[model samples]
Target: MAFFTKEQAKAAARRSENMLDQVAGLESYSDERFDVFLSHSMLDQDLVVGVAMLLKEQGYSVYIDWVEDEELDREHVDKETAERLRQRMRNCSSLIYIATDRSGQSKWMPWELGYFDGYKDGGVAILPLVDTVNSGFDGQEYLGLYPLVNQVNQRLYVEDASKVHSDFWAFVNDPSR
Candidate 1:
């Protein structure tokens, strides 16, 4: 097998960098403690995993579905689990939504958005990462579909995943200003 050409290697490196950029606090903020809620479609697992890892490194509690096996079966999603996630979303100082694909009719993403919608006034911040340009022929598009938060709408998008992490952190760190 031939090694990747220089251009191929550079492309790979750029992709890696883009993955890291999807979330903001990957550098280990051992001193700052914050709760982060991650909402996204399963189609965007790549970006979600990156954000989760970065937030975990930053000493932030991250509530990510599917990662850590927190995802509940559609039929088994009891009230308790819903409440737990809801509470996390409502109380988390920072809410990061990896909206890389359409969550229009997703299993739980819309609900997560609803939770954030209710607590927008509590200073709960909302950050979105649009990692993908399109989610294959699902016949659904997610470029501009934003989760509507109460009076305040806070969402950001990036075609590159590497940059999303830093932007997310910046939003979480300075949500008010």
Candidate 2:
């Protein structure tokens, strides 16, 4: 079956061109305000919250899925929540995945990484971190991250908050990225 009509493709092309013009208009202050989505595991909850607070303090609209409490009756990492988080990521200008050595052990984290991998090829900006690499680190499934690594624009150490923001802003302004 055909994925898109010829006319639909042409309209999409036109919309992309218009978006370029809009992006050019916001080139100056792109860093001050951007659509950001945070993909992180529960193990890294503290780090995610800290980053969210910092971004909010800087006046950015950050979408952190784990920041809000989930319904107790439903499975915390069920399909519903994943889809909601995926929607938020799709709407954002950038995606940030908080990586810890323990990330590989969790079933949901790898699934989330797969979602980010798809976005990277679509020209979405992705930023990932390697917080630690010990016993905890060895347990991490670096294999899962291999596909997205090439798409990563910045590989900051987890402790570096300033660097994360800097890279995030850079992605926001980079037209080719």
- After superposition on all C-alphas, the RMSD of every candidate to the true structure, in Å, is 10.8, 16.2
- On TM-score, the leading prediction is 2
Model 2 per-residue lDDT tens digits across residues 2-104: 1112233233344444332333323222124335666666665545555554445445566554333233223445666667656655566666554444455
TM-score of each: 0.49, 0.50
Clashes of each: 17, 0
Q: In lDDT terms, how accurate is model 1?
A: 0.46
Which candidate leads in lDDT?
Answer: 1
Model 2: residue 132 alpha-carbon error in angstroms: 9.0
Per-residue lDDT for 1-177 in model 1, tens only? 011122322333345454344434343222333466677677655555555554554455665545333344656779977776665555566665543335454678656755675666433333343323221212133322432121112222212222222343444555662
- List per-prediction Cα lDDT, in the order shown: 0.46, 0.44
Looking at candidate 1, what is the lDDT of residue 1?
9
Those runs of model 1 whose alpha carbons end farther than 4 Å from true positions after fitting are 1-34, 56-60, 68-71, 122-170, 173-177
